[model samples]
Target: TGTICTRTALLDSRATGMFMDLAFARENGLDVQLLTHPIFYNVDGTLNEMGSVCKEVEVILWIDDHSKQVVFSMIRLGKTKLIIGHTWLHHHNLEINWTTGKLTLTQCLSDC
Candidate 1:
């Protein structure tokens, strides 16, 4: 639809136009990315290392401890909640219990 459509009956001075909608997008999916300071952490969640990660169409959950980088990539991508850090993105899929501060690991299951 270039300027406007021809079927709408309008007044002589009125105007009409068309715009792109979400339904027309090719990649009909949400971009869930995380940008953060890459840090490494041990099993006890202690400081190990630090760094930055640059990614495209990917998720990362980085915990730095002892100067080491820990990156946890996600298999499934969502269309909402794009987490961003200072300069990079750290993608981490988490299912937090609203009732409690317990952190739960998210698993990516195959649809087939």
Candidate 2:
């Protein structure tokens, strides 16, 4: 249970779930849990033999004065660290401004 204090995150609307770098998770000393089922995907949608995903971790997302805890599945993404995907965005009712490259939390649910 480690708190993510980094502001640098990529907002990917096309991504279905949150993802974190395996190396980063290890460096942060985050507790990674094994998934019952493995997730497989490539950046180009081509099949690659990267084995199964056996790790996941919960991270705290801090934005401005608001904060939220989110679970991220660990993967080996080259050069990319944190990626906030559609699931998290929709769950939090977040609005993204493409023009200004800004993210706004439209509504806060009770859980959030």
Candidate 3:
């Protein structure tokens, strides 16, 4: 949709899929796509109080010198705006240095 914006994102190993805050997506004027199937729970099987997740957006995520188009499901996130979850980490073969707070992508799929 050519919408470009930057925001703090959480890299959560516990999360199963990428996510974007609903309000943030609206504020950035990102084009929202309706999900073919709505989501009703978190990956952990906990109930989501915000109801079903029916919207999503595709955006180019830039981290330092790397960039990739990612789809983030729209949901109500309390304080966090964006989340790069385990699916992305595993697909990219990401390595994280907990001591130094550094992230490295060791591999890329054929798409890259």
Q: What lDDT does each candidate get?
A: 0.27, 0.77, 0.85
Deviation of model 3 at 23, angstroms: 0.3
lDDT of 2 by residue, 1-112 (tens): 5444564788787988888888888888788888887666556766645545668888677886678777898887768888888887777887668898777776867776
Q: Candidates sorted by lDDT, descending order?
A: 3, 2, 1
| lDDT tens digits, residue span 6-93, model 3 | 6778998888889899999988898989988998887678888877899999888887667898899999897999988888888888
TM-score of each: 0.19, 0.75, 0.83
Task: Tell me the tens digit of each residue's lDDT in model 1 across 1-112.
Answer: 1121112111111111111112212143424244364324433566533222222232223222111122222221234222223122113333446585444444322220
| Candidate 3: stretches off by over 4 Å | 43-46
Count of clashes in candidate 1: 24
User: lDDT for model 1, on a 0 to 1 scale?
Assistant: 0.27
| Clash counts for the predictions, in order | 24, 0, 0
**Colliding residue pairs in candidate 2:** none
